[model samples]
Target: MTNASLTDAQLARSIALEAGALLQAIRARGDASGKALGDIGDREANTLIVARLREARPDDFILSEEALDDQARCAASRVWIVDPLDGTREYAEGIDDWAVHIGLAIDGRPRIGSVAVPARGAVHTTDDVHLPLPAAANPPRMVVSRSRAPEIAKTVALAMGTPMIAMGSAGAKAMAVVDGRAEIYLHDGGQYEWDNCAPAAVALASGLHASRIDGSPLVYNCADPLLPDLLICRPELAETVLAAIARAR
Candidate 1:
C-alpha cells in the first residue's frame, strides 16, 4: 500500500497483527517450547516485520528488539520501534501474556502505535480506540512482572492500598491498564525502547497516562535503546502513583 493510503497508525496495527499471526502459527505447530520456541518466534517474527517495514516504508528507520541495534536510527526523525514477540518466554510456554508491538516515534516521542495480543485476539492501537477502559477496580490494581515484580511497584501498591497483579510482557501489562484489567502498570526494572513504545502510544491514545517512572515524557530513537523504567496507568492515578513512586524511592 502507498504511504498516503495507509496512515502510520494503520501501518502499526497491521504490522503488529501480522507479526502476532506469525507467532501464533509457529506455536500452533507444537514443535518447540521453552527457549527454543521463544528463539524461533522472535527470529521469525522479527524477520517478517523488518521485511514488511523495509518494503512499505523504505525511508523510515526501524529498531526492533530481536534485531541488531543500529545507532543510525538516532539520525532519523521517524523511527519504527517494534517488539515482534514480546514476552517471548510467556509465548514459548503457551501463556497469553505475550504480545506483538509496532510503534512509530517522531521527534523522539511515540506518535502512533499498536499492541496485539494474539492469544486474546485483541489489538489495541492509536488508530482505533475500540475498547473503553474498564472502570478502575476498588482500591485500584497495579500490574507487575510475574517473575520480577519491582520493589517500587510493591511499595506503590502498599502505599495505595491496592492489590498487585503480576503478568508477563510489557505490552500486556501496559494494555491491561488500557483494557481496564488493571489500573496501573509501573515498571522500574530494565527495558528497551521496543518494549514499551507501542504500548505507550496506544495508552496515550486511549486517554490513559504514560510516562517514565519519574513522570518525564518517554523519548525513543536514542543512541541507546535501554529504557530503564516506565509507567502506564489510568489518568486519574497519575498523581497518586507518581507520588507513591517518589516516596518509595
Candidate 2:
C-alpha cells in the first residue's frame, strides 16, 4: 500500500495483524520447539515484517527486535519499531499470551501502534478500545509472568497494595493494564525493544501510562536495542508505581 493510501495508524495495525496471522499459523502447526523454535521463528518473522514495512514505507527507517540494529535509524526522524511476535516463548509453549506488536516511533516517541493477540482473538488499536477489568471492584490488578516472577516484582506489588496475577508474555502483561485485567505490569531484567514497543504504544494511545520504573518516558530506536525494564500502569497509580520501584531497588 502507498504511504498516501495508508495512514501511520492504519499501517501499524495492518502490520501487526499480518504478523499476528502468521504467528497463528505457526502456532497451529505446533512445530515451534527448543532453541530451534526461537531461532527459526525469530528469523522468519523479522525478515517478513521488515520487508513488508520497508516496501510499504520506503522512506521511513525501520528498527526491529529480531533484525540487525541499523545506526541510521537513530538519525531518522520517523521509524517503525516492531516485534513480529512479542512472546515467542509463550507461543512455542502453546500459551496464549503472545502477540504481534507494531509501533511507529516518530521523533523517538511511539505516536501510534497496534497489537494483535490471535490466541485471544483480540486486536487493540490506537482508538476506540477499552481495557478489560477483573470481576473485583478495586484499584486494579497487577499481572506478572508465571515463569519469571521475581522477588523485586512481588515486592513492588506488595508496596503498591494491589493484587498480583501471574501471566505469560510481555505483551499480555501490558494488555492486562490496557484491557483492565490488571492495573500495573512492571518487569526488570532482560527484555528487548521488540518485546514492549507495540504494547507500550497501544497502552499510551489508549490513555494508559507505560514507561520505565522511574516513570520516565520510553524512547525507541536506540543503539542498544535491548530494553531491559518497563512499567505499564494506569494513570491514577503512576506515583505509587514509581514509589514501588524505588522501594524495590
Those runs of model 1 whose alpha carbons end farther than 4 Å from true positions after fitting are: 1-4, 130-133
**Candidate 2, position 54, lDDT:** 82
- The models' CA-based lDDT, in order, is 0.90, 0.79
lDDT of 1 by residue, 1-249 (tens): 663368788877888888899999999999988999999999999999998888888899999988887788899999999999989889988899999999999999998999999999999989683566667888999999998999999988998898998899999999888888899999996899999999999999999999999999999999989898999989888998999999999
In model 2, the worst 10-residue window by lDDT is 128-137
lDDT of 2 by residue, 106-204 (tens): 887878888888789888877644555345327567898888886778898787677789898788888777877688888888887777887888888
The TM-score of candidate 2 is 0.90
Error of 2 at 221 (Å): 1.9
Q: Poorest 10 consecutive residues of model 1 by lDDT?
A: 1-10
Per-residue error (Å), model 1, residue 80 = 0.4
TM-scores for candidates 1 onward, in order:
0.96, 0.90
Quick one: best lDDT, which candidate?
1
